[model samples]
Every structure is written in C-alpha cells, then in structure tokens.
Target: MWSGDELDLDAYLARIGYDIGRDGELAPDVRTLTALHRAHVAAIPFENLDVALGRQVPLDLKSLQGKLVDRRRGGYCYEQNSLLAAALERIGFQVAGRGARNRSRGATLPPVTHAVLAVTIDGEQWLADAGFGWQGVLEPVPLRAGARVEQSGWTFGIGVEDEGIHVLRSLRPEGWTDLYAFSPQTLYPGDFTVMNHYSSSHPQSRFLGQVVAQRPGADVRRALVRETLSSVRADGSAEERIVDTADLAVTLEAEFGIELDSEERARLERLHAAGV
Candidate 1:
C-alpha cells in the first residue's frame, strides 16, 4: 500500500495543480475528491511512451512520483490510478484497487487489463478512475445501479449487467457505449504487477508497437495515436490530421507536453514511419 510519507505530498499536490490551503478545507469530502480528480487528469496525461520505447513501466510509488510528478511525464492507467489511489489514501479517503475488462464491443469475458478505484467517502461508495484516456469519467460517481453523471458536456452511467459485473457506459450519438466491465473483486498489488508486466512487455500487447498519449483540457481533448493527432471538442466534434515524420518530436512536445531525447525521438519516428 502507498502511504503519504512514501512520497512528497506537497510536490504531488503541486504537480496536480491543486491548492490545499486555498480551498480552506482539508477534509476528504466530495468537493476535495472531485477537485483532485479533475486536477490529476488535467495535469498528468495518459501516455504509453515507455512501452513504445521498450522501457519497463515501474509501479512503485517512488518511481511513479519521480516520473510523473518530478519529471512532469504522463503514464497509462496503472501508473495514473495507482498514484491517485495513494494520494487519496494519504488524504484520508478509503480506497481499494479494482480491475476491469475492456468491453467496447460488449465482449463478455475480456481480460482484466484496466485498473480502477472504488472509494468510500462519507458512507457512500464512488468510482474514480484517472487513466481512461480521452473518454474517461471526469468525476467520481456514486456506485449505484442506474446512476448517471454529466461531466464537461459528456454523460456517463454506471450499472450492473446480468452477470453481476459492473459496467460503465458513455452516452454517444447512436447510443450508450460500454466502456468496460469488472466485478467487485478487490485487486492486490501483485495482481497489478502481473498485468502491468504483460501490458508493457508482452510481444502481443497492443501498447508495444503503438504510441498513445491523451490529455483533456477545459474545452478540448487531445489524443495522439501513432502518427495521427486528434482534437475532440466538448460538443463531440473532432478534427484529425496525420503528423509529418519530421515534425513528430516538435508536435509531441508542443501539443502533448511530452519531451523525449534525440535518440528516443528518432526511434519513435522510425517506428511510426515504418507503420509496423
């Protein structure tokens, strides 16, 4: 478990652009939790650069803090949610790690590759996840059947399927899209270690050959998938373009705030150019 003392709480708070004193309330309430969630997504992006670079993704608090907070880099679900869970625990919120499966196409028995959080605050349980990329939930919603939440012009709902697994859905123009599904089973650190290893190292892992980075702004969300750059507005409209090979480094830095060294940049350029 990650303790507050294990990391620099002040620095972590600053990295998320959260103001503790200014809020004048230090208790772990809905307001604080929502603010923290919003700040985290806005500050630390959802990225898979290390996987693309063939670097091991570390799950330890020290490494996560050093990379995400200290270096101002972004990470995927495991890192982002782990960091948020630790911070919430430090702030006196009752948090438990949960795992989920991608259910984009209503696939019933998908592998539990995604990580989420089950938080209990003031005798109510809520779902909080900071690493769902572009279509992530913006705030913690009550863990109740048929509960609906509207955030930043997007609508999300939580419900349980017939199989007794909780499913999260997003409101789309056509209909509700099933984002992911998971049971109420609690996940331990070791489980995440196994899942993370497969996600970051396995040859068949989708993240291995792709470069994905996403960050949500106040009105627009930016996502970079391989060589394509997409910007989606709050109204669900989107604009996309294929990035030139020569401009990849500059675009990554300027648009996504990800700065890689010359060698790293060259490697990514080659990988994307080859389209392997």
Candidate 2:
C-alpha cells in the first residue's frame, strides 16, 4: 500500500533514474517492458562495493528505499530486485517476488540469493528480472518453454534447472547454456539476511572475492572484477574489459549513478584496502 500519497514518487524514480512514469499504470506492452528493463540497466548498477566497505546491507523496505531510492546507492540482487518490485507494484503491475539460486555455482548454495519478478497481466506470467548481474536479461522473457524468447536478436528459452528450479537458457550456435534459475517461492525480507551476510562475508563467495560491474547504458552492461567486464550486444557475443576499482566512488557515480557520502567513501576505501 502507498503512504497516503505523501511518498516521494518522483524522488524514488530519480534515485533509480528509471525514466518510466511513476504515477501511471505500468504499460503491459512488450515495448514498455523493454524500456523498463533498459531503465533499470542504465540506472541500478550491480555492485558489492558496500559489503567490501563494511556497511550493512539492510533488507527492510524502509532501509532499502532509503539506500537505493533515496541516497542513490547500488546494491546486490535482493536489494535491487526488491526495490524494483515495489516500484512496479505501485505502478499497478501485479508482481510476485520469486526466489532463485545459482545452479552454475553449486546445488548446495543457499536459496533466495537471487530475486526475480513474475508480472501477471491478462492472466499471463512474464519474467521480469533486474537483479541477475552480468548476464541479466533486458526484457521480460516468456515463462513458457520451447517457445524462444528473442530480444535484441539473441534467443532465450525456459527449462528446468532441477525438479523445483526453472532455468533460463541462452540459445547459442553451439547449444543452450544455462542462464539462471528461479522458483515460485516468495520470500520475506528476513530470508535474505543470511544470504547477504554470506555474499558479503564468505571468502568463497564470488562476490566477496572480486567482481566489478556497471550499467553504462540502458542496453549496455559491463563488469570486470571477475577479470572480465563483458558487454553483451543485441547479438550474443560481447566486448570485455578487465575489472579494477581505481576510483571507486567515481565509477559508482559514472557507471552506476550512485552518490556516496564522504563517510561512506572512506569506509568503502578502507574495506577495499583491507580486502575483508
């Protein structure tokens, strides 16, 4: 429910820089979905800079809104996906918060590390994800299988990652490669705390190790901390950059549109230097 129309909708949109209308119904057309996806890509960046800096990445709604929609900060999947869900819901889209796991990482990894959205309109479920870093899709992929969901020329397919996990696969010249997996499980904010801790603290986690990503443009996505910052084109093959954090705050603002305070910057720099 909205806060008696006193909520700052424009500020919220400005925080994310998502150009979509804040007070109107989310347009159900494919064009709207594409545009929204691009806005998210250009606006919300995928960065673990906060965790590396020892800042607590809170999952509560107010905290999330303040950091992501007010302070113009970037966050990991749960925060990014969760905030987007709130905005879409306010715009009159029937959105469902779904859980996902990284099948490529390992089967035993904790659940709910990834969050996705299932938007229903005209009784059809459309996949809307703003949080699956690097290989993130820029449009709603159809939920049906064998039905190729083509965007910007590349084709995607939906299938089973496991009994309970549904996977998104990219149709390449060689074969279909797994993209990511999600379940119908709707999670509360509390479910993410542990995962966030692991992602931020666990040395074994890829994010904790090193990875750099930026949403340079609506359709342009890149990251290098993984040793490869790849930018996927409408066509599948991508251009890559080596990841490094020389001037992190500048990168945050330039690449992700995040504005960090001096205290926040000092904390982040300290953490990065400590590598904890």
Candidate 3:
C-alpha cells in the first residue's frame, strides 16, 4: 500500500528529527500524525531547483528516498508529499493523494498541479500536507468544513466550495487568504506522475523556467522564486528583495535549509545568468 515497505522508516524519522518514532512507538494516531507533519515541514524544505535545471522529478519511492532523504535535498509538492505518504503508510496510517489547484497566485484558477495527502484516524480524515511550501499548515488540518487550527501561532482553516471542493486557507492580518483548493477525489501515484511530467517539462509550467524554494515558518514564511526573495510575516506585512546570483546558494541554505553540490550549484548559477 503506497510502497510503504520500501521506505526507510528509521532514516526518514531521523531526517525529520522525529524521535518518538525511533523507539518504535510511532502510532498511526493523530498525535503522531500531527507531530510528524510538523517536524517534516520544518526539516525538509520545498524547492523546484531540479525542474529549473531541466531534470525530471521522479515520484517512485526509491527515487524519492534517494533525492529527498539520502541526498538531503528539497522537492516540490509531488515529491515531498509522496515521501510523506510513504512514511505514513509504513506506519500503518491510511493515506491517499489529492490533487489541488493553487489559488494564491491570483483570481484565475490554476490547474490541479499540487499534490496533498488525507489521513484517516478512527474513521476521521485529516488533511496532512508537507509539500505546500510557503503557505502550508504546520499540523494536520481537519478535513471538514469550517475547521480551524492554530499551529505555532500561525492560524489556518478549511472552507467548503462549490462541487464539494475543500479550500485550504491561512489567516493573515488582513483576512483569510486561499492557499489552494482540493476536491475529495482521491488520486493515485500514477496520477502524480502524469502531473509531474507537465510540471517538469511543459513549456508553460511555472517551474520549468525558474527556481522556486520555500519555507513556511511560524513567525515568517520565505519564498525564493527565480531572482527574488520574498518574506511574509504573520502580520500579513511582506517584503521582496532581489537575490543576486552570487548570494543565491547562501540564501537557499540559510533561509530554506537547502544545500546543493558544487556542480549543481554551478549549474543553477549558470541558469540564473542565462536569465531563467
């Protein structure tokens, strides 16, 4: 089920700094679920550097483990969420994938390019996502309408929409802002592969021509897209500053906790110089 047995559970727990699971008490209960979600978000970052480098984003559990776990690299929604799903399933949690449309971009509805997870505990489903990058919930959000939760002083909520869709929103100083909208329809690993193709190679894909990395921190969220670095405080105030190519690697490591090898670093800097 979801290639759980193929995952290196102990390695994953250590990667995310989750000790409770190390002693083998890692339950499929909500407490462990929430803790795992929180730790994973803080440890593994969200990034699209590989796609920007014109590489394929693999979704298999083996490739996911190699890049995200062994290599200590960050990935976008599909890779991040898939790794999480494998860990959850390995621990006996019922997990399913859901496709989501990114709404934070603007009024126009984006495609269902995002991947998320739904976990069931005692018949109650919870929204557990670790791949949403900058505007993601730090804990497992209830999979119900009008459900709200406060995580690390940051607030989040779920709202209902037309056609039984569920929208994930964050509470900002100005008001609630939509992060993404997802339907209850469960997606499979194969579905994610198809979407990944478009995201990695499609000419019109946002990730195709630029670098994107994000860290959703409690006090402030950080997003590094292409040549710009944006920080949004919990109070809703924000700042955007251009990141010089020379400082890109440092910014990625210091802000998003991502470090690339020398060749990869040189390639990224070249991509930047080439106006990507």
lDDT of the structure predicted as candidate 1 = 0.85
Score residue 20 of candidate 3 by CA lDDT: 64
Over 111-144, each residue of candidate 2 has an lDDT whose tens digit, in order, gives 4467677777778777888777656676787776
Candidate with the larger lDDT of 1 and 3: 3
Once fitted onto the true fold, the runs of candidate 3 whose alpha carbons sit more than 4 angstroms away are: 21-24
Residues 1-276, candidate 3: write the lDDT tens digits. 589999999899889888863533788899889888888998999999999888878889999999998989999889989999999999899999999999998798768899899999999999998988888988899999999998877899999999989999988887889999999999999999998998899888988878899999878889998899999987678999999889989999999888988988999998887775
Q: All predictions: root-mean-square deviation over Cα?
A: 1.6, 3.9, 1.5
Give the runs in model 1 whose Cα sits over 4 Å from its true position: 105-109
For residue 11, model 3's alpha carbon misses the true position, in angstroms, by: 0.5
**Local accuracy of candidate 1 as per-residue lDDT tens digits, 1-276:** 755558788898899888877754556888889989988988888899889989999899999999999999999999999899889888888888888998874556657899999988878889999998887887888888999988888888998977678889988777888899888888876777888998999886778998888886767888888888999876778899998789888888888788888798889989878877
Worst window of 10 by summed lDDT in candidate 2: 1-10
What TM-score would every model get versus the actual structure? 0.94, 0.78, 0.96
| Residue-level error in angstroms, candidate 1, position 20 | 1.8
Q: Give the top-scoring candidate (TM-score).
A: 3
